[model samples]
Target: MSAGDLSGRRALVTGAASGIGRACAVRLVEEGAAVVAVDQDADGLAELAKTVDVEQSVVDLSQLNDVDRLDLAVDIVVNNAGLQHVAPIQEFPPDRFSYILRVMLEAPFRIVRGALGHMYAGGWGRVVNISSVHGMVASPYKAAYVAAKHGLEGLSKVIALEGADHGVTSNCVNPAYVRTPLVENQIASQAKAHGITEDEVIERIMLERAALKRLIEPDEVASFVAYLCSDAASSITGSSMRMDGGWTAH
Candidate 1:
């Protein structure tokens, strides 16, 4: 199918307020898809709705009941909502750990489950999980985040296998650290955690972790996600597309 073949199709994106979610929503609309933008930030959702033909919903994805409340039957679901907490396993708060899993893993499961009947009846659908390079490798101070992402990858693969005959494809997009507000805030967060300056956090922490020595852009990840959701990606399922700039190469 052509790049512009998304006309009349509907897509729902979590975390649509900012970062990769915002970029993906914009890109999907540009390719002719009607979008449902979901986020906890009502202000951000309002801004996003003004930019496209989007149905905006303000819901906290960490709550399973919130996922159940979405009533639309869309052609695609992008589970992009997530959180990052930095702490050693010994220092990590149990509540924070639970929150991360609920948002990153449990919520995706619920959203996919809720969309299944609709997708199966329609005979076509796509589920794109916005995972991370941490999903593939280990990182210090990201215990809960990494674990949830890893679980999300495994869950996507299973859905791909189970949904194939029904014409529903499930896959993941794993990108290295991107230059989003989330990552930018990490400069301060990591610096405080490590007792270093923001410059040191960027140079000695983040850049050092990446092979490319550069942070990824949200648009780059968005384009890859948009491609995966397109009809051209029909043959692609149960796979992890790495946009990690070779971070996992080592």
Candidate 2:
């Protein structure tokens, strides 16, 4: 999509305080979309709002009730909020598992359901859910995160089908390890869980899983999502675009 196409469009991005969500929000504004940024970090959200024409809101996506207010009327909704709590199934806390599912899967569903209502009313909208390569295939010690991401992919598909008639397209981007603060934290957690160094976690656990053997840049993922949000992607709903560096191809 071109800058002119997004000039008057309004975009709401969850988890917009940092990492992929922040990058996506910044890119959308650059593309000329009016942005509403949502995150749990009030300070971070404040920092982001200063630079852009952003309406900032503090939200804990894990609570389903948060969606009541998240459904701000907008032309685009990017469900980029998620968590990575790494632990073996046997050792994982039940509360942590539920927490991951709530934020990564359930919240996205609520956001999409609410957004679709507005989208249907307007007759044009884009729903972009940011998933992960773990949604396609998994490794050791990321059960909850993997399950939630996998579930999110399924939810996006259903939304795509149901929203089709209303001219609302739903799609997901399943990216490989991106060098964002979220993934940095995940690497640290993995290193701690598996008794490996952080460097080893990135080189062995993350890169080894990717054919590219490198971390994906946030902009790479953001660009694809921006495209999906465009009129050019009108026929691209109900699809999972893999930015996984051929990890699933193997």
Candidate 3:
């Protein structure tokens, strides 16, 4: 309840079996908050549970019904589950677009909408959405992803204004191309889509816009998320915190 610690807090983190979500689960636990790890990957959740004492919820967030089934009474909600599809706008499949938005945007909206009551009652809470650099800007061949992130930013802002009096802060952490399995998969997809090698995808495409010239590790982003969740950042609501390696500096 105080700055720098989460002794009695409970956090619900989606996509928690791996990548940034996994790192967040570990870090928040280290900060003393109990975590409920949610993901569609049953095997990965089992693996994560083997290492940490977390309640595992194996639900496909794309399934709105399953999202509703989740125990929504928690002090923190980290909406980090996502996927990407790279294609020119004209070639983008309508179904894929809808699917991405359902998982990335609609699911978060539902989770936060359901969880707000408990947070408001408790008079304290945090909603840390793991958005991407695309949330602030855009890139070719990622129409659906870009749209979903953009929507997420707007959702965070609205939540901030409404939750301010209730002590619930909603914010987005925008990082550029993190070193995660998702990004790794994107590299392969990009390489094929662009007719280049994976190394070229990383160097000439992914890192091209980033001044840091390297991928961001999941722990680094997770650390920032933990900070936002801490009492130290009670004033930092409805803000988009970018860890984009100066990608937006352009």
Best by TM-score: 3
Q: Residues 68-104, candidate 3, lDDT per residue (tens digit)?
A: 9899999999999999988989999999999999999
Worst 10 residues of 2 by lDDT: 1-10
Model 3 / residue 61 / CA error / Å: 0.9
Q: What is the alpha-carbon lDDT for the whole of candidate 2?
A: 0.86
Error of 3 at 207 (Å): 1.1
Q: Give the top-scoring candidate (lDDT).
A: 3
Q: Which tens-of-lDDT digit does each residue in 99-195 have in candidate 1?
A: 9999999989988988888889988999999999988998888999999999999999999999999999999999988888899888887788799
Worst 10 residues of 1 by lDDT: 1-10
Name the runs in model 3 displaced over 4 angstroms: 1-3, 192-196
Model 1 lDDT on a 0 to 1 scale: 0.89
- Candidate 2 deviant stretches above 4 angstroms: 1-4, 189-197
TM-score of 2: 0.94
> After superposition, which runs of candidate 1 have C-alpha atoms over 4 Å from their true positions?
192-199
Select the stronger candidate by lDDT from 2 and 3. Answer: 3
Give residue 237's error in model 1 in angstroms: 0.4
Q: Which residue pairs in model 2 clash with each other?
A: none
* Ranking of candidates on lDDT, top first: 3, 1, 2
Q: Each prediction's TM-score against the native?
A: 0.95, 0.94, 0.96
